[model samples]
Target: MTAPQQGSDAKSNDSSSFVTFSLAEETYAIDVLQVQEVLKVTEIAPVPGVPNYILGIINLRGDVVTVIDGRRRMGLPDQAPTDQSRIVIIDVDNQNVGILVDSVAEVVQIPSKSIDPAPAVGNDQSSRFILGVYSSSDGLTILISLEKLLSDEEWELVRNI
Candidate 1:
């Protein structure tokens, strides 16, 4: 089924919106524009020969979406799935990919001024995906760059899927 862009028309004309979610006890976020939909944990059919980060694929309506274990992708210790687990569908290069988050948090608006460049954390691949960090009363939230999340080889694999 086609993912509905719920409340899609309500996006702002000036400010930026982000969909926050938890991963490995830390809060993270992605641009709202890239979010297609949010779904509960569903049965995934594992595909062989793929990276460990890729758990498998799930059939959403008629479309098959690749599911990525967000924790594993971030090099965090593996945790069993729970009731609050959610698959956040996002558009990466126009393709929808599911990020398995521990729990999805509420969306928030962070103006350009509030977004600070991510400090260098060596040259790790995961660190490269961090766009910036936002601070508020709730504490620090890391913003992820979905565009750079996967490497070219990984993207090529996704492309050939």
Candidate 2:
């Protein structure tokens, strides 16, 4: 999909608008339409028999939202956040979940010209989660394929619950 264009008022933009955030030293972004809200770091209840990367569930406004440790999912060593951690609440496959990010960054307008297709080389699993790379003044933002990121098996489990 091509990046969306914007008018004078930003709020009226299309679903392609993206909210960027930081994880470790790298930057990433997801379609703004996919993001429900951004929340502060909160307690998560552990779920047994689930993957370790799945950091359990969080209670958000009376709704149980699964929390995923993004760093762990990327094969990075875990480190406790020091006042900079944030939870980006996103809806994937009709399920609301919180992705633990290092910090929340600004929402940027990534034109179609700035986004490049995901590289076919390197780790296949990682590539599957990425949709494209958006170049910006700050740095490159890895645009995530939210639908694909939560694989079919995972979505089925969440849906069944």
Candidate 3:
């Protein structure tokens, strides 16, 4: 919850920067501007009666931030946290939320023209959150829309948590 990088320079007219991270062995990115800061996996105080995706809450400075398990949210199996695991605090719906990622890669700046629209695939709940895709030399990076990461009802539940 502390002010680290404001990410003011994460966007431009010709291109947009992204904060890339790994999840379920796949690469995913979020608009860099939405990223507040990254923190190492810490002791999470688990809450009862919440959904499985809600890993629990963390005492980030004086703020009680809800940490969501990215794997669970994406319908992927859960894995134990490793040394590379991190909590990526992102700006979602005007509030700071933490997304547990496998490992953070890097901040990549991709040209606007290079970004491709999300493919028209079968109706999948997770697919709705995909903003676009970027094929880089390393591989393809799935860009996600944090706003759609959760439904209005889900957001309300998180707020109540």
Q: Estimate each model's TM-score.
A: 0.87, 0.83, 0.88
lDDT of 2 by residue, 46-86 (tens): 88878777888888888888888887766656878658899
Residue lDDT tens for model 1, 1-161: 23446664434323478999998889999999999999999999998888888999999888889999998888788998899999999988778899999999998888677788998883475688899999999999999998778655765686545
Q: What is the C-alpha lDDT of each candidate?
A: 0.85, 0.79, 0.87
Ten contiguous residues minimizing lDDT sum, candidate 1? 6-15
Model 1 residue-pair collision total:
2
Q: Regarding lDDT, does 2 or 3 come out ahead?
A: 3
Q: Largest lDDT belongs to which candidate?
A: 3
Order of models, best lDDT first: 3, 1, 2
Superposed model 3: Cα runs more than 4 Å off: 1-13
Pairwise lDDT winner, candidates 1 and 3: 3
Candidate that scores best on TM-score: 3
Better of 1 and 2 by lDDT: 1
Better of 2 and 3 by TM-score: 3
